[model samples]
Each structure stands twice: as structure tokens, then as C-alpha cells.
Target chain A: MDLTPLFLPQSVAVIGVSSSNDRHPANVIFSKNLLRYPVRTHAVNPKGGVLHGEKVFPSVSAVPEEVDLAVVAVRAEYVGSVLQECIAAGVKSAIVISGGFSESGRDDLQTGLVDLAARHDFPFVGPNCLGLYSPGIIDTFFLPAERMVQPPKGGVAIVSQSGGILVDLLVKFADEGVGISCAISIGNKAIIRERQLLEFLASDSRTGVIVFYVEGFARDEGRDFVRMARDCGKPVIVMKAGKTNEGGRAVSSHTASLAGDYQVFRSVLKQHGVIEARNEYELASYCEALSCYSDKSIEGRIGIVTGSGGHGAMAVDACISKGLSVPGFSESIRQQLQDGFSASIRSIAAVGNPVDLTGSALENDFVSAVETLSITPEIDCILLLLLPYLPGISSDLGASISQVYRRSGKPLVAYVPHVEKYRMLIEGFELNRVPVASSIESAVNMTSVLRRCRPC
Target chain B: MLKKEIQNILDSSREVGWVLEPNAKSLLHMAGLPVPRYGWAENIEEAASMAAEIGYPIAAKVVSPAVVHKTEVQGVSLGIDSQEKLQEFYRKMSILPEFAGILVEEMVEGEELIVGATIDYQFGPTVLFGIGGTAVEVYKDVALRMAPLAPEDMSSMLQELKGGKLLAGYRGKEPIKFSALTEVLLSFSDLLMDIAPFIESIDLNPLLCSAQGCVVADARIILADQ
Candidate 1:
């Protein structure tokens, strides 16, 4: 059995709800939403029924219809009895959001839970985790999945082994404006391995790009999985968890797995065409890039249009870092970009591969320059760099810049080289399906990821 | 003792495939494994006398260790019916590279087994085993285990093969002694473990299994330190 109910949970019983505690709202929030989606909702408590006017079932077995999912939010000791009732009633999935079991170094409970999960064939998500959401069906997100679910699902699917970390990434990606197809919190992966989910995602049309958060993968099985990703023509970006020396040990505790031959894994990943991300955020950036190329019909030579000389120079530096060579600027495209700028801003130029349009280049200069650069015989994609407050630049900016990028349908990546200026720019591009990174490092890393993803 | 002598020989020689058998016997002598008593001769007269001393039906092999796969060169004569055959084997042994004297010894009788280690391109050194001797290629049953192992692990490894029953003396014969096997295994491990990085590989094929004990009849060790 796929343990269908745990992920696609229909009715949920949330244990441990209290009014006095601040974090206690977690049970109520999920319970309220589970009721709203009209999944059979039960408030399991010894205190009696009637929380938000719904009759509470004293135990999981007491509830009438089949309980698809049960969220055990009590102390770790009480979790066993709660699970016993669920198993007795034949509940298929359980999301154990309580802690102090294995992570606490406790033996009996942890081993018992492992044995229990295997016997029932009921895959449990986490012993300590932020629960997931199926969007429209249920928003059981502890980190507030509703605010994080940005509209219009493009084709980016996620199979994250880390529940807490995955939720953090989901929130960040949602805030950045990239919609998710289905982000799975496949905690521990005691039963369902990454390869099986990868195969499932490959068959799903909703997934254009697959971002895997791997703490560990079975040794030789990884090579076959990478080959399968290539066969499907889906860009699989991996943010491997065990890169650090400390992360290696932590991976064993997080998931019972051995970190094997990282250097050899990297070599094999390259051989099978898996794009490796340096970090979690960069992995997300690569996924977004592939999502655009897979779902949208955006293509052609790139144009690096920028507000400052540093911004343009930084983009060029990033392009090289990502293993991409800047398209040569012919005399005709060069003169047009020059004409789009003021005479003073155009001529003091340390003129080169990245058309440095000087600090005086405003929003309109960006729009005009991109239009002229796109018509060039050389450029196929545009890497647009903009600083939020250029000395003479207007504040009403990104709207006009957005129009030009939107009109061309040419892939334009926008970024503000400083961390503080990144938020608003990220939001602007987030709405447009264009990526806007906050730092030179993130922006360059994003482009490098883009170079690996072929826009189908 | 002979291993050290072989080392001195290897340390001096700049050629390859030349020190094949004698060099192997030297390694076996150093490891304290049982080896055949033989005489090395510079001439056919010397080879005939050595064969006579070894008694009738002695094994006479060409002395050039360079002649790997000696049967390919018509360089070996086993159970020689006469002194004339010993003279013929001695003459052929002289033609091969680094040709020394001939070896005339009483050949051991029993099942032959192959024990070897090959350096894999990815996973370092791997130890291999199978039923051996000249007809070994026919059975084609082999087992492999990673190296740098303990003596205790070897028995578990021995038990893995389907032919373990036969090795343990099936029917009426005595079981292939683990003590004899352990000695060779410990010697093999020390040769690999003690030298550190010097050895790249070691192949001991046709490790003769006699009624008394196991004898390393032929072997090869490739050095990496050079």
C-alpha cells in the first residue's frame, strides 16, 4: 500500500488542544481547517467535547467514519497508546508531530515506533515535524501553509526528507512567489525512498522540475535514479544534506542512513546529468528556473541589462561562475544600448561583454535597453540587474521594468546585489515567475542553475 | 627468509614477467606456507640428476619465471617417463627471459584452488577464490570479498561458497583444515597489511590441496611501491 491517507488525508483527529498555551493553537488550527474542508474532524480529549461547536471524540476508535490521518501533538510517552488506537481502527497514515523520542536518544519508544510502522505498513511522517498540506483538500501546515500556498501551480515538485527544514524552504519559496505543485515531507524515509517518489514525480505532469532534499540515498540506487531523471527529461536538482563534516553525523540521527563516498557521488551525479546545488536556497533557485523552462514557452539569447556598472559587472562574473560565457556584443547592439542611456552615463564606460549602462540608467533606460538588446543577433536570454534606489532613478520603478520583461517573454533574471533591497525585488519577480535573488552569490548561483536547466 | 631475498631481487630488476615462479616461491617461503622441495639447475645434466634424486615420475618445469602459462611454450614436462624428457624440458626452460635453472620436485596430489586479489578501479583491493588448477576455468564458480580482513572473517567467507561442503571433506575424506587455511589467510593478510602500500595485488592460483595439507604451488605478487 502507498499509505495513501497520510499524504492525501481525508479525515483527521488532532490530539492535545488547550486554550491556555500559546502554541496549543496548532491543534485547533489544523482541526478547524480539517473541519472546513469537511473531512471528519474529531477533538480527542479527556476534557469532553465541544471545541468550536464540534463534538469531540474521546479517542481515535470512538470516532465513527475512518480516520485517514491523526496528528499526535502530546508528550512522546502518550504517543504509543494514541497510535495503538489508530492501528486498531485501521487508520492508514499518522503524522507524529510530537518529539523527545529518537532525537532525545531514547531507545524503547524509538525502536518500538520503527517496529510499529513496519508491521502496519502505515508510513508515519515524523516523530518531530511540521505537518504538510495538500492545498484545497487540507492545509494542515503548522507553519501556516495557507499564507505560503501562492496561487497558480507551475510544475515544480518537491520531495524533501527534512520536514522542519522543508517547511522553512517552502515558506521562503512561497514568499519568493514560486508556486509548488506538491511539496512532500517524506520524513525519515524508513519505507518510501527518494527513488520511488522521484519515479512518481517523473510520471506526474504537474512536476516539471523535481527538487530533492536528500540526507541520504542508497549507494548504487542513486546512479539509476539519476539516469531515470535524464530519461524523463526533467531537471533533478539535488541539495544533498551531508556535505559538511558535522552534517554527516547529524544525517544518521535525522534519518537512519550512512553517508557514502560524497566525492564519488558527485562524480556519478555529473555522469548522469543531476544538477547539484551548493545549498538549500540554491537548490530552490534551480528548481524555479527549471519550472519556468518546463511550464512556460520562454526562450532565446540572454541580455544582461543593469542599473549600475557594478551590477552589470557582477552579472558577468556570475555568468562565468555558472559555466556560462557571455554572448559577444556586436557594434550594432552596443550602439543601441548606448543610445538608450544618457550621453554622460553611456561614455564614461568601462565598456565590455556586459553592456554597463552606468548608475544613471533608470527604469525606462532598463526597458529600452532590454528591448534593443533582445533584437540583437547575439543575445538569447537577458540577465537584468537593478539597484532599488539609483541616485536619479524613480521609485515607481519595477512596474515599468516588469512590463518590458513581460512583453519580450525573454527570460530575464532580476536581482538587487544587497540583502536589504532583495525583499521587494524578489516579490516583484515572484509574481512574474522570474527569479530575483538578494546577493551577488545567490543571483550568480541561480543563473548557474539556469544554465543546467534547458528551457523545454 | 626467501621473501626478503625475492624483495632484494625485485629491488634490483628493472624488467617484468621475468621473476614469475621463483619470486612467488620466495614469497611463499617468507609467509611460512608449505612449498615443494626442488633443485634449480643450469644444465640438462643437472636437471636429469635432480629428477633422479627426486625419484621416478618427478615433475620437471622450466626455470624461467618469465614464462607465465608455461604450457603455452611446451616448457613443462610432468611425471617424466625418462631422463630424456627431463633434458628436453630443461632446454626449453633456458630460452625464456631471465632464464635460470630448472625445477625438479615431487608434485603434491589433491584438489587445486585459486586465491587472488585484484585492485578494482573504484573499490580498491578485492580478494577472490574458486576451485583451481589447470581445469579451473571450466567450473567458473568464484567468490569475492573485500580485503584488509581478520582471520575470523575468512571462515564466514569460506562458508559462503556452495563448494564449502567439498572443501570440508565430503564423503570419507578429512575436512579441508581451517587451521591450514587460517595460516595462509593470516600470512596473506600480513603480506598485505604489514607492507602497507608496497603491494598492489597478489595472485596464488593452483594452491594445491593435498591429503596432508594445503601447499601454495604457484603464486604472484605485484608491487606498487616501485
Candidate 2:
């Protein structure tokens, strides 16, 4: 499946532009693509006069020149006709952003569109979805720019069943400054499903890690997913929902009961080297870490360098709970870490495994400690818990820390929690490819996954 | 060897369902799986004689198409050490109308394990491994793998069982030879793969695993409808 046109389209046509209301979803998507994205956008309304000062084409066929992709934002009733027009106009890829299809109990409409897409052999995203948002390339989410925040462009591609969940995760990722490769809302999965997208993204240079938020799988697609993920050679993270209550909820065999379909799903995925995330937070954290340092592999031992003793203890507990080792720094490494800092910092901080740099520790203190452990044979990875409220620390410390992290080649994840005020420092770390987790638990969770991750 | 034996069972079958004990044991043995020594005895005297030859400790089970759960029907007698005991137990069980013959077999004592294969509705022939016994349904500590399995897959499946630690010698008990268990799992997977189309389900309930090696204590193979 050559999905290049679907993801990398140069020009896109929004098929249902409302003439009267600017609040219409189609118009909203059109305006977002026009103002923020690089793709050329065309508006289509049957009563065509103008939309956003660009001449609205009466139909897709009426649009001048070839369009690579079509965004079908019309009502579910007229979606099939618009698709036919797109096919007639030689459009190869499309995203059906309309609702009232299968999800609204209109199976006939969904089936008709599925059949139409099949006959044309062109891939379409969804019938009731937020649509595709390939950062810098295209943004088809109907939600307006101000309301729907977009994460910076990076290497993690998200394919989710719920559009609302995708938006929530995107907002969080944006706030944390986690870069994204593509965010696809595969609602109803009418035409293109997870397997096809996974196959496409597996070879995609832009996508380093593939994350799935699936409500359910279609029959044998689960088996196909496992096979493809094994061969993809990239880390695949799945956050499967409806697992606790879905298939085999009333099973007969103890094996089937204890190893329910969900357990089997998890085991099979893990057996194939796919990381399974238990919740939305872990899914996002794993995506951030894996996308940033997909090339590096960590093995258990983590070096914790934090500004506060309380945060360091919390991180240690989290790591230990997940079967990760937070080994005490060796005598030589400990002595080196202590020597790098002045007496004021050393007297206040604990020079142990969860190396507490104390509240007064400065930027150079953090850099030197991390730089030493980065080369230390015992430490497999590094975690920095920075609380910028301390008078000695400034956001400028991010640049120096990021530089030291890059030079070390060890997987480094930062946790900077407070609120929106710390955005600059967080962005500074993320800009240089260091993912910042929201909490201590998630920071350790990401560390554990990265440690177990073996690059194929 | 297995192909010829399976063909014979299919040719001689007048009805479908559980394959008879002799046939099931023959299938297992042909696939290089271990089964306790036993024979179909024609009479009470023959049952006693077979038990004496197989050794002092043995068991006798009534084999009949009407009785799927033999123990539930009170059709099984265990620990027949002497001829007097064998004859006495056989007299009580052989009177049942469903009794086809008496199967005198060696009594295997070890940790109970269940190895089963089913034609999954979606993934096709899948093998299951877990602790066996009546609590098999309650303590559903099992793992499944699509057959035929690789060597490593077999080991991992065993390791995944809730009772996996028992095989590794828990407490003061000697560990059941790991290679022996692996052999049984691998052979079962191969057999399931071979007869997957005709077989609906194959269960080796209470497949005994001990320091002596693994052996099939009870075996049943359910055939699919033509």
C-alpha cells in the first residue's frame, strides 16, 4: 500500500464548505490548513461563490488542476457522492471527516463508502473522526487552531480509535513540548485500518515509533498486527482499551479465564517485542521517549540526578516498583559526582543512587554529575528531576544539560513539573531530543520501557 | 507412522467424538510422547494378570463410548496392588452396562499438568499449557501459542504457566526434567499441526511431570464433524 499521497499530499480539497457559518467544521479545517499548514487548500460547496476569499469550487470535479487528497467533511448522507466525485476527479487519497455513519447506526452508509473506497482502491481515513494531522504537511482536524493545540513535528505517529482521546493526548504532548510525526484518528476504521497504517509507517522515514490506541480489533487483524510489528524493526506501542470487559469475559477454561483474550493479546504482543501500555499516560510517555531515542537501548540500571531529595526518592520507588535497578553509584563515581560540586551544594545534597543535588544545586553541578554518570559503566540511562523554583536554577540550564546529554549518547528523560510557567525550559530540553515526562511515575515508566526496548 | 494410525482410526470409526483410549495412546506413543504401561484386558483374571505384570501399583478404568467421565460414573479403581484387590474392584466396576473392557494401566504419581490443543475460531490450531486437575477451570493459569511451536516458544509457554515454578523444583521437591516437558509440548504441537483439520480438540489432562520424566496419565482426542 503506497500511502504517500494520503500522508504527504501537497494539495488538499475540503469538500463541504458552509457558505453562511464560519463555525462549520469544514470551514474550520479549511482555515486551519490555509493559515498554519504548508498544504494548498481548496474549498468546495455546491452553492460556490467564495470561502475565505478563495473561489469555492462547486464540486471536486470543478476544481481546477489535480488534487492529491480530498477531505470529505460533508454530511454522512452525501459522503458517498462526494467520494465518487473525488474518484472521478482522479484524487488518490482521502480523509472522510463526516459523522452519522456506522457510529450513528447507519451501517448501510458506512458499508457503501467502504465498498466505494474498495472499488476505487484508494485509502480513506474515517467516517466519524477528527481526521488526519501530519504536522507542517496537513491539518484536517475540524477543531479550530486555538481550541485544538498541535504538538511540534517529530517522529512518533499516533493512530487512535477515539478522536477525543487523540485530541487530549495531543494537547498534553503539546504542553509537554513532545514532538509528533503524525496523529491519525481511525474512527470506525471504515476503510483504512491499523494494519495498513502500521505497514505504511513501518517504512516511513518520518515515523520512528508507532503508537496505537485501539478500542477493538477486527477478527484476525490482531494476528496480522503482531506479525507486522515483529518484522517492522521499529518499536510498536499499543494502548488497547475495552480489554478488561471485551472478548472472553465469560469464558469456560481456566486458561481462557486467567489468560483472557486481553491477556493473550498483551502476551502475544509482548512476545513479538511490542510494548503494551496499560493507560493513556504510559502510552504517551513511551511514545515520547521511544520517538526521541529510538536508536538507543537501555538495560535496567538507571542513574538518577535530581535537584530535590523528595523527587529523587519518588523516582527511585517508581523505578524499583517496575523491576528497574537504581543501583547505588560506585565509590569512584560517587566521589567524582561529589567532587564536581562545591561544598555548599555537597553539604546539602545526598551523594547516593538517587543522587540528590539539593535545592541549591546549580546548572554546572547538574551537568558535571550527569556527564560523569553518562560515562559511568554502572548506569545504563539518566533521569533528571528539575524543579526550577529553586533560586539557583534558571531555564538556561536546559541548553547546557541538553548538550551534555547529546554528548553522552545515553538515553536521558527529564521530569519538570509545576505548571505552564516552565514551558521554556521543557521546550529547550525537548528541542534537543530529550523527552520530559509529567510525573515521577511516568518518568520511571518510560525509563523501564526504554531499558527493555531492544532495537531490531 | 502417525498418518497410517490416524487413517486406521478414521476408517474404522462408525461414529464421531472421543477417540478410544487405545487409539489415543497409540497416537501419543507414535508421536514420541510418553504414556504409562497398560493393556486392554478381556476378563477380570486378565486384568489382574496385566496389573501384576505392569507392576504391583496400577489402576483399572472402564472404557466405554457412553462414559466420557469415567470417574464420575464410579467406573475407575486405583491402587490395585494384589490379585485379590484387582478382582474385587473389577467385580464391582465390570457389572456396569457401559463397560466395554477393563484398561489396566500403571498409576503415574507426579505434579499434574494439562496440555490441550483446540481449533481456535480465528487463529486456527492453538496449544494450551497449564496446571491440570479438577481446579483446571478455577486456577486458569495457562498460556497459549499458535501451533506448530518453535523450541523457544515451547519453553516460554511452559514458563508462562502459573504452576511453572513447580516444574523448576519448588520447595524441597526435585525439578521435573525441563527437557522432558519441552519434548512433550513440542511433540504435541507437531501432532496438532499434522491432524489439525480432522481433530477438534486434543487434551492430555493430568499429564504427569516428575523427576522420572513426563508421562501422559489420561488422554482424549475429540474429532471434528466431517
Candidate 1 regions exceeding 4 Å error are A15-40, A45-52, A74-90, A99-121, A134-158, A181-184, A203-208, A218-224, A231-233, A244-260, A295-302, A339-351, A395-397, A417-428, A454-456, B1-226
Report clash pairs, candidate 2: A154-A180, A254-B140
Task: List the candidate 2 regions with Cα displacement exceeding 4 Å.
Answer: A20-24, A45-53, A74-78, A104-109, A246-254, A345-349, A360-362, B1-23, B38-53, B61-77, B82-103, B118-125, B146-148, B154-163, B194-203, B220-226
TM (chain A), candidate 1: 0.77
What lDDT tens digits, residue by residue, belong to model 1 across residues A1-456? 464576566787777665345347346555546555666666676565566667767777877888888877778888777787789887777777777776677767867877887888766766765555555555555553334544345677777778766777776776545667777776545445677677777876666788888776754456457667667677888877765444433210100111124543553455455788767668766666666555343233456776667767767776776656677787766776677776656666433566666776655666777677656657666677777767756544555666666777666666754355545554556566666666656666665666556434
Best-performing candidate as measured by lDDT: 2
TM-score of 1: 0.59
Tens-digit per-residue lDDT, A1-456, candidate 2: 468988999889998899899999999999989898888889999999987789999999887878988998888999999999899889878999889988889999999998988987978989888878888899888888888787888888999999999999898777656678999998989878999999999999998988899877776677788788888989998888877745534432333344455656676777677899998778878888887888778788988999888899889889889889999877888889889996688777778988888888887888888888889989889999989888888888777889988887888888888478887888788778887888998888879889657776
